[model samples]
Target: MNAADSSALVVFSGGQDSTTCLAWALSHYERVETIGFWYGQRHAVEMECREPIRQGVARLSPLWASRLGPDRVIPLDVLGEVSVSALTADLLVASSRTDGLPATFVPGRNLVFLTFAAIAAFQRGLKRVVTGVCETDFSGYPDCRDDTIKALQTALNLGLNSRLVLETPLMWIDKAETWTLAEALGGDGLVELIVHETHTCYNGDRRTWQEWGFGCGQCDACRLRSAGWQRYSQARSWRVWD
Candidate 1:
């Protein structure tokens, strides 16, 4: 790879998608670092799962493990004060906003995350930011769109007067495709590590373990993941994971 495709800093959340992206970066980049955000989300499983996930991946894929450097978690307590989404709210309603935005949509969450990640990457002399923002299998968050990421990338580069590559490995792919990518990257063991360890539930429920992970299995995030897992399993001629 050339200088343009060298090292990377992944905006990791210890969730399934982000974990896959981190692995993707590790496979492709010369070096990879991860940054997490503690923005006062109601479901803090993603934040809490980071260390164990790192350890689990290390055990599963040692080649990528050493590439995983110290992951930083930036605390942004003020973000909770300004947003009324299900992620930040004390009481979350299973509905949409008055203007039709998803109830789980935390306003400017990705933007803030990428901005901070960019700053950290800049400081570390890293010019690439890998994120797991998927437009195909998501909860309709506007910030997850490709154009939004491009715009932010441009603005960040112009503001800092530095060229930074914002990489989104899962941008156009759906859940099943994501699973396929994970299997491609590190086979079934890596996929199992992600399914059992990473948390993707909005309700923070991990009691019922499924093929896709532990969640209520009814929430938007759970449904998407479960559906994808089902599709991927069927494609492999394996019985559905119960």
Candidate 2:
């Protein structure tokens, strides 16, 4: 990749997926910066894990430490004020009766995140924005779909009149593949960082420690992570046997 295409801004949320994406970006890009949003999420604890996860990821490899750049936390409380969802409010974690989308699906969250990430990337002279919005094994969020990201990428480039490429390394992959990807990017150290430092429970329950990570183990986020970890573990065991 050319120097112009080598820097990327990752939309990090200090969760398993975002942290994995951060490692992936650090491994691939010459320079990788991270941006997080404080949108009044119920799981606001994830915000607290951001720095620790970054520091842990950097310590996993000298190359990653050298490539990691400054981190930015943008306050987007407006999103919480406007959206009525389990992630932003004290609401029941269930599917919407009308739209069939999960209650944890914050409307326009990814769109807004990517929009701000684009602005940050533009100012920082970063051409690519990396995110971990996977369609597979997700909560059926419309904004997380591949079509939405592609459209937004085109719109962002046109609106800013800049060549800003939005990259989703986890778009088609399942959560099991995501864990494998993280291991591939930074080995067992990266996975350990994710397990010990990342937060994903919608309720922000950091007190409970699952084998996969810290979560309530009942919310959609925790369930997905748990299932993925089981699958990944089983696959790894099978490979070892083979």
Candidate 3:
């Protein structure tokens, strides 16, 4: 498939980074589709917001929305059964294991997500897979590392005998830069959508909405997102949401 005119499947999770990556894919790819995982994580509300977020983006960016395709939500309940983390549950003791991994880290989550996305893309003749995992701002998840992604890409290609480009738009960027990217992708409305619509809190408390979306404002995800938005909000002169 030609790189200039190829379709992409975004490994979306309805979080800040994934949502931004979705917008990035829509603007860059010839045709864009999304696949979200429902692995029985504690914050399942993230999945629930996917359609509204997609539709909101479509309303704001019609041209890119025209290239958008159906978004699929896959069930991976078995993955939840095997993994014991804060994301799945409060099984572990320390927030970070002795090995320095956070309690929220789900074993093989990204690998499974990308592998499944690759298989789906290969079957559909798509050559690109966009993901929102960022090593820079990501909180100690080994699977979110570039090396892991690169190795998985190689293995997927060798296993399937097809070159699948794994695109990480936020790989090297920090959270502040991510907010900037969201704004650049579709201006203030896109930024507003990310701030108020997407769910990133590990605790899944939707009691209030802040610059970092709806959350408890105390979870790891919220802290990182809030800190990033603070930095981004100060650095640029964009219109803030009401």
Name model 1 segments beyond 4 Å from true: 2-5, 238-242
Candidate 2 lands at a TM-score of: 0.98
**What is the alpha-carbon lDDT of model 3 when measured against the actual structure?**
0.87
Residue-level lDDT tens digits of model 3 in 174-206: 999999999999898999998888889998777
lDDT of 2 by residue, 73-167 (tens): 99999999998888888788855647777888888999999999999999999999999998998988999999999999999999999999999
Model 3: weakest 10-residue lDDT segment is 90-99
Higher-scoring candidate on lDDT, 2 or 3 = 2
lDDT (Cα) of model 2: 0.92
Q: Rate the local accuracy (lDDT) of all candidates.
A: 0.87, 0.92, 0.87
TM-score of each: 0.94, 0.98, 0.94
lDDT of 2 at 187: 85
By TM-score, rank the candidates, best first: 2, 1, 3
The alpha-carbon RMSD values of the candidates against the true structure, listed in the order shown, are 2.5, 0.9, 2.7
Summarize candidate 1's per-residue lDDT along 1-242 as a digit string, tens digits. 66545889999898889989988998888778889999888779788898888787767777787777778999987888897788898665368888888899999999999999999999988879999998888899999999999999999999999999999999999999999999999888889889888999888887888767899887788889999999988887754343
The lDDT leader among the candidates is 2
Model 3 residue 26 CA deviation (Å) reads 0.8
Q: Could you tell me how far off, in angstroms, the CA of residue 149 lies in candidate 2 after the best superposition?
A: 0.3
